[model samples]
Target chain A: MTPDPHRAHVPAVVHLDHVTRRFGDVVALDDVSLAVGPGELVGLLGPNGAGKSTLLSLVAGLRRPDAGTVRLLGGDPRDPRSRTGLGVTPQETGLPATLRVQEVVDFVGGHFPDPVPTPELLDQLGLGELARRQTGALSGGQKRRLAVALALVGRPRVLLLDEPTTGLDVGARQALWDAIREYHGAGGTVLLTSHYLEEVQALAERVVVVDRGAVRADDTLDAVLRRVSLRRVVLTAVEDLAGRPGVVRAEGAGDGTPARQTLYTPDADALVRDLVTTGVEFHDLEIRGASLEEAFAEMVAPEGAAR
Target chain B: MTAPTTAPTTPPATAPPLPAARLAWLHLRYQVLETVRVPIAVLGNLLFPALAMFFFVVPQREVAGDPVVATTAVAGLALFAVCSASLFTYGLGVAEDRQLPFDPFVRSLPVGAAPQLLARIGTGAAFAVLGVLPLVAIGAFLTEASVTLVRLVAGVGTLVLASVPFVLLGMAVGYSLSAKAALPVVQVLLFPLAFAGGLFLPPQLFPAWLDAVSQATPTRAARDLLVQALTGEPGSAWAWPVLTGWIALLAVLAVVAYRRDEGRRFR
Candidate 1:
């Protein structure tokens, strides 16, 4: 009965408190702390080897932390009772080579009391046609889909998906996203990791950006995007405007076109105010938030490098 | 963040855990199914001992005609079947399973490892029974090995008892070795233990030093006990001690191997 500071309110479906995990001399999670309330879809965004999978492994109860506590459903993650409501789809899945897709689902589902029907779950993941096929015979995308289907068959309250759509095509990735949304819409919580920023932008409500085995930024999706604080301002001007106040970089008119220019700045509002005060004749003015791509790069930018 | 619900903060309870026997049965069903679907997998264990019974015991009239010799041969090969199945099932099977991508998924289940580990032993026992079937059929039809009804029943029970140490020893091998090393290790251990234990030939035919050394092996102890069960004779005074000692030894090794594997993979 360790003291639970997190037990005061609605308990987190997944909670990690100052958790530090190590592999020999390397720290995979460095005194990290996170909590996901019930029904929250949080995306773990990081570069490869950023400890995203390691963190998920701790939550999934496949590994234990070197320090601190991890609670799943209010019990220690290592306990079987605590994991009953947890489902996980790892980045790489290995299915029994000879087992049929339906059978694999059935085997995993049987661990839970209220398992989804085999055929029904398969249909949801678009693996209905491959239900009878041996998992070894499946295409990479199909196997990945089946792996997600295995995670969902248990109807767990929380799903931990690591790189769920790594190798999927656009169509398959979309189908998988729809299935995930459908599950979430039904009141399930999801904590997923991805190298694909669009994947996070499309599905995550909250984002935790991890780098070098540490949490660099954790906030809502918009906040994480806004946290980079880089704005792209595009305007059509008769005169070049590359070196205006607050502009970090700009794509001024090329030799062939002088009327269009794009400028990037940290303070779009101040830049705009400066523009109007300076009486720069500008039309077609537009300001946009940093895309997650640029946001991630800037947030986890190399040490000692300019922001 | 706003609380998602006013529901109790307690962990979501699953339906009370399933009965242990039923869970074990579920695991056993798939374990057996996984093996049988690949028919060649079964043959790997059943083939060698049946072939031994065919080539070594069947063609010799004197060896086959004498009830004592023939019955001892039957018992020896029967033990071989158990050891073979136990070793390959745990040694090769468990090792290969650890390398599979599905392994972590299964290990993460709420059913815990008990049901699955029990089911593995159960599957090994079931297949061991099958491994003996060909030899048993050959003994009944092609040889003159004979016994009373009571001894026959006792022999079956004794075989089950004697198989325990070997099963535990197999698990040690299974948990400790990688799949690649398991095959050659099983082979290297299997034949020597079988030979030194008087499983392939009687200990009475061995040199004194070899005979003394054979007395130390778990397989030799098993053979002595099984032969005594099939025929109303006293096994060596060392039989129970040998079996008990090996069981304790192999149990420790198996446990250590299991923990080491967990440490390597997940710690």
Candidate 2:
């Protein structure tokens, strides 16, 4: 099997071409293609089981795609040499309970050609105090911090982190984010997946929204946010204006009595103009920009409809 | 403590990859440490054969005093110890590790599985040696079991070599089944195979039909070889061939089970 010729020209640190993965009858990833360039931080945003983990696994060489090729550092992912420059933190990792924090770090770091010292790695992750503690004794947040720390020990060229801060508190999450930012700043490519909209918004320069085993949108974070740039118009109206022009969706207590109706539209001004021209009786009208959460919800709504 | 916002400078010189021996030793050290911390696990493997010697061999005057009988009895028990260690350590240990999240992390490392498996086998062998110690002491002090230094050395060698099949069998069970199922399966297979192989009773005591059947089992082959080494007797003609065949079969099974498990979980 030959390497994908076009991928060589693109300087991608991680590349997948028409990758499809299935478990029995369920398609986990369907004809998905992605390329992450050197030093790029790409956030994979999706709900649970949205093929986010599957995609990361494929690139990490932890899983093989049912069809298509996965390349890491211009080498086939299945080769151990290809993983020499790769580091991954799966969604859940069970550290050896009996090994002290420092020993575990040292053991894993020893495998890499250029690994950060154990103490330095621990200090960077705010885990220095717990270095002597057995991993089984550490709290959930502390363990999460250590897991992320292990991913950085190798000073990998590209890091794959799956919900690195899932169980962390606000303070721990911030600390982890700082550590991640520092690594990325050092010219490391990173692909991270998260269900937390704020985490991606706060960290990712590029966003890939996945749902129902396919990429719904992939572009710069600002571009994706712009693509979902819809305003929500909420008001108490006496008539059902759900089918009004320019209104993408409208729902409320449409009982013919005056009740609050929330309408989603690409152009709130046009919806309001249409409402006014029709002489609809309304009150307490308010318009607000859609949040990233709302945009994410709209992106994945098709999956719900298919069900 | 607050974390450093700035990334540290890269090390001036990258360290070379550690030798496989060093990695295997490191793995062995940690595995031993972990098992030792759970003192009961160590005690269990150590005491079972020792207690069996004290109760079964120590009181039998006819068998305890005769050099040939005592030596054979002690050698058989030592092989029993190796079998137990091989079965429980790899079987239960691998099954338990499969349940842990840590196993995946180790599996994903650049270092291949050989070192880890070697370390595990080394750990089991170390425990197997420990398991035989009490029996050796009891045989030396309480019973009149005696052997030449060369015989003792050869007997130990035989014990270690004979453990290969059981170890592979353990791995096969561990990788093929869940911990819940593997535990009982190891236990269920252990005692019956031990009895049929004449680990507890002498093969001479078995009926002709049972003794003929026992000759084909790995356990029986192990016992025959160890006894031959210890007592300077000619082992059954079938012993070497039977053990070699079992080792070959179990090795293939172990590899298949390992690949199947890896495909199911990691792939």
Question: What DockQ, between 0 and 1, does each candidate earn?
Answer: 0.25, 0.32
The C-alpha local distance difference test score for the whole of candidate 2 amounts to 0.81
Candidate 1 off by > 4 Å? A1-7, A90-93, A229-265, A268-291, A305-307, B1-15, B148-150, B205-216, B248-256, B263-267
Which residue pairs collide in model 2, if any?
Answer: none
For each model, chain A TM-score? 0.80, 0.83
Q: Comparing only chain A of model 1 with the true chain A, what is the TM-score? A: 0.80
lDDT by residue for model 1 (A1-307), tens: 1223255676777889999998888889999998888778889999998999889888988788889999888787667777778788733457888888888888888887677778877876678898899888989888888888888777788889999999889998887887787777667889999998889989998889898888887888887666666898989987677778788666656554546787778799999999999998889889988775775676686555543
> Across all candidates, what is each one's fraction of true contacts kept?
0.29, 0.21
Local error of candidate 1 at residue B258 (angstroms): 3.3
Give all TM-scores, in the order shown: 0.83, 0.86
Candidate 1 chain A lowest-lDDT run of ten: A1-10
Among the numbered candidates, top lDDT falls to 2
